[model samples]
Structures are given as C-alpha cells and as structure tokens.
Target: MINPPALTLRRRSEELFNSAERERPHKEDSAALLLFYAVECGLKSIYMLRNNLRSTDDERANAQSARSFSHNIVNLMIALNISRVSIRPAPPIVIARSGLSGHPLVLHEAWRYGEKVKDANTIYDWLASLIDWCRKNR
Candidate 1:
C-alpha cells in the first residue's frame, strides 16, 4: 500500500535528521541541508493533512496555497493556523534573530551550509523535536 505524502516526508525528515545527528565528517553540510528539508517537509506534510490534502500532486495542484510556504518555517506555522505557543521548542522563526546571532537557521538559506548555523546541535534538536511534535499532532 502507498503511504501518504505527509508520512513519507516526515519519515524522510527523521531519517536525514538521524544521519545528521551522527556528526560524521564531510556530512555536516549535507546533513544540515537535509535537516532543514526535514523540517520543511514535515511542516508541509502536517499542513497538507490538516488541509485535507493526500498526495504531493494534491499539494502541487494547490501550489499557491500548498507549495508556496515550503521554504520558510515561520510562514508554514502561520499558514497551518498554529499559534506560537502551540508549537514546542519555539521554532527558530519565533526566536529573536538577534539572539540567534548569525545562526543560519534564522537566515534564509543559512542552514544550507552547516557552518552558518553555529549551534547545529541546538538547531537540529529543535528541528527534530518540532518535526516530531508536528507529525504526532497532525
């Protein structure tokens, strides 16, 4: 049987996060990239499920509403109609960028290059936790 896109995305997100958490050499960048993807996909998956969407195609067909929010985590949470307090770990988007102090997760595409995140462990932990919570709630 085919799994739903939400499940698929969450699963992949978990897999990548696990790999990133291992901290292997030369893998940090890719891991970070995937980790961000994991969160993005996880959020989208939940959003799609809540919006009565089933497949990626379903999301694509509604691209304006579904695909558009894939990049920014802050927007995804808002589009999901989720309040800041409702989300655990208080996603980076909700955190003050000044506090993050150059953390890539706060900046657009900064996390793509693990070096920019500064505290990858914290970001990873937060993202992993967020994905877990979002997936469970969805």
Candidate 2:
C-alpha cells in the first residue's frame, strides 16, 4: 500500500471540486460527481488499512467494509445535495470506466464533467495517462 502525500490529496480534492463546479451544469451530474468523490475518499481509507492490518483476511474484510460504507456515504451526499431524485446504483463498470485509475479523487470531477472532456482516447489510453499522472505527481 502506498501513502499518497497529504498535499497531493488536498490539491486533488480542490482540483476536483473546482472542475466539477465549472463543468457540472446539470444537477444530476453534480450529484454524481460528489458521490464519486466520497467513494474515492472511502476507498482511500480502505487502502490505508492495508498498511496497518496484520493479515490478508483482515485487509480483504476491511476493503469490503470500506466500500460498503463509502456506498452509503455517496448516497447520503447525493440526497443532501440533489433533492427530488432517488439515488440510483451506478454499476462498477460505469464508475470504473470514467478514468478513475489514478487520482481516484478525479472520479468526482470526471463524473460531473466527463462528457465535456474532449480528449479522445481508448479507455486504456485514458487510464494509462491517469496512472502516469498519479505516479509523477505523487
């Protein structure tokens, strides 16, 4: 498990929030992005568990628990921010497809403004770029 620097997390979060504000015109998009960001943070917490847990079993359990908790958090955030619409379960594929490999924090921004992103590339290319950026910046 790798511990991303605190500065990186703060910068990533700020960037995501700023980007979401700029690109998210629809309420649903904004909600989705917010939810995605919460999930990303939750995942980070789970990732951190790997460093402290003693056994693989504990690590796996922690990861699953963190994901469940994050899902709930996302739902709550969505409900709070965007009223009048029931939160829908987004498939993992859809969430994963949104170029979230690196800087998981970017998932929020992407969720909100991914459609506006004009960089045309295969999913692999997009993911690769994100991973590279994470490595360089981290």
Candidate 3:
C-alpha cells in the first residue's frame, strides 16, 4: 500500500488537474492534464510490474527504470506549466523513495504552479485537452 503522504499528493494532484480541466479552456490544458495522468499511470504500472518481478531478479533494475520514467514524466508536466508553483516540497521524497517520482503529479504542480495559475491561458487549454484525453483513455 502507498503511504499517506504519497497518496495524498496523488489525490491532490488529480484534483488540481481535474479542477483545471473543468474550468480552463482546451488544447494546452488538456495536454498538461493528460501528461500528468500518463505519468501517474506510468508510475502505477511500474510499481505493479516491479512487484511481479521474479524474486531472483535484481530489484534495482526495475527501480532504475521506474525512476527514469518518472523523472521524465515530471519534467514534461513542469514544461506544460511554466508559471505554476509547487504545492509540495522537492520531488516529493515519499514517491521518489518508492521509485515512483515519475508519478509525482501533486509535487510537480504544487512545486511548479499549484493554485497560482487560477486565471492563466495555458491552464485553460490544458484543462480542455485533459477532458478529451480522459474520454479517450477511459
């Protein structure tokens, strides 16, 4: 099971993304939301995959891959919102310790944008794109 801090970050990130999606415009907002969602999914996938690995396999191998993937995903999310502020602290240590930094949705947003982009153009577009992505992905 994921820890409270990590889980809270995920839920908060999802909520922020959802809020952005509903109130914002389209395109960029959707992309931002989708990017976060993808990262979140990728993080979860890596965790499940790692847990299923053979006991004889090196856990570090799976951890490394998951870490790299998560880092990239977080970077993408940051790029999507250059003006946001982070609600959480550095890289969200809880998730990173679990090799799930790629899924630090809340950390990225809170650290980057948080509630700062309440009336930004990019946020609007990101929200719209998020809705479309959610429909297709779902």
lDDT of 3 by residue, 31-69 (tens): 454445544543333343434422212245334323333
State the C-alpha lDDT per candidate: 0.61, 0.38, 0.38
The backbone clash count of each candidate, in order, is 0, 0, 23
Model 3 residue 70 distance off true place after TM-score fit, in angstroms? 4.2
lDDT of 2: 0.38
What's model 1's overall lDDT?
0.61
Displacement of residue 63 (Cα, Å) in model 2 is: 13
Error of 1 at 135 (Å): 3.2
User: Can you tell me which runs of candidate 2 are displaced by over 4 Å?
Assistant: 1-3, 26-31, 38-138
- lDDT over C-alpha atoms for residue 108 of model 1: 41
TM-score of 1: 0.64
Please provide TM-scores, in order, for all candidate models, with all chains considered together: 0.64, 0.28, 0.28
lDDT over C-alpha atoms for residue 105 of model 2: 36
Model 2 lDDT tens row, 1-138: 433533444355446545544544545455345434533443333333433433222334323323333434334233224222232322232344544343333444564555422222232233333223333332
- After best superposition, candidate 2 residue 34: deviation in angstroms? 6.5
